[model samples]
Target chain A: MRAVPRCVPCVLEIAVNTVERAVPEDRQKEAILAATERVSELYRMEPTPQPPRLGTEAQRTVMKYSEDPDPYREEKRRANERAAAVARELESDLENIEDPEELLKRAAAAAIVGNTIDFAVAGHEFDLDELREEISSAEFAVFDLKPEDLRGARVLYLCDNAGEIALDKLLIEVLVEELECDVVVAVRGGPIVNDATREDAEQVGITEICDVIDTGAEMLGLLATEVSEEFAEELSSADVVISKGQGNFESIPEEPFPDVPVYFLLRAKCEPVAEELGVEVGSNVALRWEPEDENVRRWREIVR
Target chain B: MRAVPRCVPCVLEIAVNTVERAVPEDRQKEAILAATERVSELYRMEPTPQPPRLGTEAQRTVMKYSEDPDPYREEKRRANERAAAVARELESDLENIEDPEELLKRAAAAAIVGNTIDFAVAGHEFDLDELREEISSAEFAVFDLKPEDLRGARVLYLCDNAGEIALDKLLIEVLVEELECDVVVAVRGGPIVNDATREDAEQVGITEICDVIDTGAEMLGLLATEVSEEFAEELSSADVVISKGQGNFESIPEEPFPDVPVYFLLRAKCEPVAEELGVEVGSNVALRWEPEDENVRRWREIVR
Candidate 1:
């Protein structure tokens, strides 16, 4: 979806967060000022871009100012380690559930819980200590496409953050083994915030079960114009797309996926996203949006 | 103080609020988009103006885009009426306090409670029903300047919001009748946000006790270069300045007031303002700052 006015401040704040990590203390003030200036320039240009595009540009500007390629390198590592421990703890619990449908719902809920590990979104706070309790009791605001919908389907999973991807592996396992679905997962081409890469997928053991491909874009979300030929091919061929987190939730709708049924799993962390998905700000959402879904009609009207 | 990264989102949000009120329903999206674009342009300018300055420009841009001179006219009127009722109810309670100092502190606290009536600041929510209870038990974070400091002094009170000014009258009454001080009140020269104007002062019975002058600028805060000659003369001669609300609290220190002992009486509404005051966000402060006070030295280092 195209950006509403609320996105400008959040986009800039995310830039500031990145700058604090990338630049040293003494030069941080100068670097942040320049980064914000460039952000303002980008906003004022003709035909204002989507928020994800703006967010990517702001991150790029900060990196350029500080001459740092990956500001979130250390943070990503720590997040992955934390996510692994939580996933391992959750593995035994999943093994106990008898019904395949209940196990699939529980796994999806756990993956949605993992979306809370993100650090780039402004004013979003997460505590790993609460993850277990949250996963057990999570309620999806929109749960249209179910376990039966993905049964024996060709599925493509879009990963969001580093630590969050580990929990996503649980849902992928459910799809490949329990539901008899052919699953492939895609990470970003390079680092942008804490978004998963090939390294993250390998670290989280996502590569061991299914194929992993990079989107060939360093943006917050996978833009149709920026993704590699392989990713585009994979995206078009998939019968079902399990788009993870807020970024992919936003960018995926911009593409022409008339026949592909996409299930959006995320914690609605911001106002605009929550409003678009018809949920409260902090609600966990597992929405199904496609050409036939009601939200697609509303979204088309909004962007137009 | 200069604008921080956190201020950009709030400033834009405030602008959006203004645009929603100022523009027609069908045309709101176009107006809001243009207003935000202009706000970005303002942020990109040289020297990077303070958040208050940026806020003023954003409001003006929305008004200009919609061709509406005062979108807040009805809201300001309602605020003044509500404030008057609250003030009338508070008069008897304030009259019962026996000690002069205790009465002064209670009255100041009541006036600070009135600062919550503001609507222009982003994410600021105020409930008028709780005004009485909040004023009764309000505690000051910094209460350095006492009644003795203002006794028989030529006090200049800088007013903030419309409904807020009615409560401000409680403190002004304390200054004029109880403390035997020569009092002068200053409102904004023109309507900006819901800030008190000459009409607001007259509506709230402020004209009955003392002289009321305007700052001669339509900006969110008073600038030294923007005030009338009469205001400049009165500002130079005042023994103590009771600066009200966040806007004045921000702009008063930007001046070269080496000798003027300014008592800032307002709730710390935003983080940057709260950080500059060495207080927690949402704390009620009645701080005395001059060249001699500790905060002035710290503020000089910040603004430099």
Candidate 2:
């Protein structure tokens, strides 16, 4: 139940790293020195033109969560351990698999398993039967198949947060196993709220599993507006898209992609999304779409 | 500077207390426990139901700043220091005053002096000349003044955050000293963006110093719409009104009160107010208003 709030500090840690990367890599030490001074001046109400906005942003990023005196060092350590476990699992699976498609399926399955375990431990109830039922009912499915489905279809796997990317990798594996598709994994290019970044995807070996690209949007739902020309081309060519999270639900346009199949997989974190899915908040919903199909048409009508 | 942010957690502590007090004193503890759980749930989501309209109010109340940990502890320590310093200064000044009004003046002076010191130490620059200039020009004044002010003009001293009411005690002292007038100290009656609560006032000794009333508004600027009938009558009858902080600025209507004067004292933490005062963000501005005054008109026109 508190997992979302607890996730804030982790998100901030990544954001801090991302912000640090904004400074030229060659001037890393200098930038940090300057950042300290800038932060102090910001705290002191000094006359700095750029300080207010930057200060607010930094304040928002750092102060999003209450600072635990011990600072969740132990929880972070455990998370690293889990990530390492997932990495090892993927590595071993990769050793046995010859085809890229098969590797993707195994990875995706691992992600689902890991996420289910972690979420359950974190007090979230996981209903495996319901999950399977939704997956089977998905129309115009956007998943990576295990070397078997990559004949001509395109697949897009929209990513989530940093530590969660490894779990996403597992989903991609499943896509590869079942769908012989050209898969593209999308990540946010810049910060909007708390979402996964391209760096996070790369760090979790998502780039190795598929052709990864920046969506140029703050939210996954807002991907249409954020997609670049090259990324848009990939999306247009893709037969199915697997969008992860509530942000995608908010931003994905309704009219333009009328016929494209999009599977939205997210844990409903707020009322609006939960109401739309006819589920309680924190419940997971995977709604699938097929171009010109009745269900897709119904969803389009409801969203519009 | 950061002191503004520090105000949020302090106010929230009082907000919790306010919710506790909403029930009978005997059941207060139980009510608080239940409210905390509800608040925790709300905190996980948007925290407040209102959006952009409430953002500024939220920012003012330190709700934006409350994400920092253990702020109540830090503010308690500071408040104690401020109260002690004020008491000592007043004790020394008591030797020179025989009349009750004079004693109130001495107390008010001591509070201002103490607050000035604290504000300066906290890196807020104070401009006494500007404050005096604004106060002298007002026709109607609302003060969060001491009990002594009840004998003179009606004063409405708008309160800011929790724990700072000790400092407000000094302002009340002045209302008692300078004028034989009515004084009404206003606080938010219900859970509001980050403004002070009636309970916070009581804890900080504000209730003892003067008549404490709920303004029924989230921010001071919204007073016109949200203030209760009794408070509105007091405002109508008052000759001079003093408003505190940016919240007041937002809630108070821009229309001039030809017979009434308003003196707005606040630290400009946001952009619009800073621009209005022709000062940088975080600068304290004491704006005096005479409903039909040409200069006040000019200032408003220039800003517009």
Candidate 3:
């Protein structure tokens, strides 16, 4: 979705959160304001970018000013370790679930729970109890597309934040073993925010499961124009794509996705995203937004 | 009192609110971002200025980019009209009280209630019921100082927002008619945010009640060095100075304040101001921060 004026402040907020991790408290504001100066120049340009893209620019600018290359490296490592311990506990719990669809839905919720590791998006507060509540109570808005929908389907699974990818492995396992789909999980090429990369994928043992590849992206998610030819080919050839978080929800091209049934699995975290999706803030959803979906049909009619 | 990192986001919020009223919805974000770019440059300077100063710069930058001076002109007029009506209602409610001290405290509460007219500080929601609740329910943190504090003493009442000055007239009436102090109300020289100017003071009938003068400041409040010589003289010579809003509370020099007790009457709206003052957010305060006061003494001891 295009940015509104409220998005400008959030850009600076993300910058402050990034710079604070790298610099002393005294220098944090200075570094953030410097980054703000750079990110703001893009505001005048046509075709406004999404929050994650603007956030990526903000993070880059802070890195340049504060001279800290990988500010979130330590935090990401800690988060992955924590996520692994929880993932193991969850893996045992999934063993009792007989239904494959139930297991897949639970696993999808686990992946959404993992998306909260994003420092640039959600602030640095993680409550496992709240996560448990959300997992138990949160219902997917559109979960009607059955496992039969993925019969012999080429599934491209998009990953978001770092530690969260450990949980995503459970969903990927369900996709491959139960749904019987050939799944390829795509991670980011570079370290930006807390988004996972090839190294993180290897660390989390995601490389051991299905085919794993990096999008060669320098930012949080894959913009259609910026990804490598291999990644683009994987995207186009996929029969069903599962988008992970708000980063992918925002970064994916608005025009090209109707042919492929892209199932967006995310929690609507911010106002703009929530408003665009016609959901309340803090909504957990496995939204099916194909060209044929009722909402997308309305969107097409409105656009026309 | 100092600008914290969270204050960074608020600066843009105020800018967005200001620019959106003047420009079309499409251009609002661009105008606010342009303003943010200019405001961020000021962060590199030392003895970092308060939020009001940065806010002044943001508003100035928006005006320059949007090519509209005094964007808040209509809002200010509306606020003044609303404030005048409220002042009339409050004036009658306060008439029943015979004791000057009781009346003055009520007037002080009225003044504090009026301070919410500021779009730069308070978000754009004006509910008369809420204002009435605040006026009645709010108690002074430091209400011990009697009208005797201004007895035979020159009083300088530093005005904040435009519409709020009508309420300031009530307090000035108490000072002049009861306390018998020569009172001067200082306002801004030029339009910045909704900060009161000489014109607003006159429009709100403050000039008819007490002496009204401009500080010759283009910003919200006076920096000691930035004000006119006359304003500086008035500031230095005033026996009991009543400063309105967080803008004045923050703009006042941290040191050199013990010589004359400056009564800071404001709501601790934002986190930084609340944190610095050791008060809860949304606390209505008649805070007297004399260097000799027990709290100030402890603060100095702890600071040292």
- The TM-score between candidate 3 and the true structure equals 0.70
Residue-level lDDT of model 3, residues B66-157, one tens digit each, is: 65667777777777877887788777767777887788788898998788555333356677777767776668655654776777679889
Q: Mark the regions of model 2 whose C-alpha exceeds 4 Å error after superposition.
A: A1-153, A178-182, A189-198, A216-220, A223-226, A290-304, B1-304
Winner on TM-score between 2 and 3 is 3
For residues A1-304, what per-residue lDDT tens digits would candidate 1 score against the true structure?
7776567667777877776677776565566556666666666555566678878888887777665787787777777777788899898889999887779778989898887755434444556447777887888787765778889999989898998888999999989988899998999999888889999999988999999998888988866667777887787688988888898877777654435778888889988899888899989888887755554454334333
Model 1 bad stretches (over 4 Å): A24-48, A73-106, A113-139, A198-211, A256-259, A269-271, A278-284, A291-304, B24-48, B77-99, B116-141, B199-210, B256-259, B291-304
Tens digits of per-residue lDDT for model 2 on B1-304?
1111222222234444333223344443333333323332333332222111233342233332234322343444445454544454444445565676445444443433333334313434445444333322322222233343245666777766553456566657656654545678887765453345776676667677678888665443443444576666666667777766665554353432325666666666655456555777755455665555653453334332
User: Candidate 3 at residue B253, lDDT?
Assistant: 51
Better of 1 and 2 by DockQ: 1
Chain A only TM-scores, each candidate in turn = 0.88, 0.52, 0.85
Highest TM-score model number? 1
lDDT of 2 by residue, A180-208 (tens): 45689987765443355675666666788
lDDT of 3 by residue, A1-304 (tens): 6667777887777777676677677667767776676667666566876666677787777777665667777777777777877778778767778887778788888888677555333356666666666665657655654667876688999888888888888888888887888999998877777788887788888899888887866676555556776776687678988888887887664533335678888888887888888888877778776644543453334333
Cα deviation at B238, candidate 1, in Å, is: 2.3
Ranking under lDDT, best-scoring first?
1, 3, 2
Candidate 3, after superposition: displacement of residue B126 in Å?
Answer: 8.9
Candidate ranking (DockQ, best to worst): 3, 1, 2
lDDT tens digits by residue: candidate 1, B100-178: 8899988999899888755434444556457777888899898875878899999989998888898999999999999
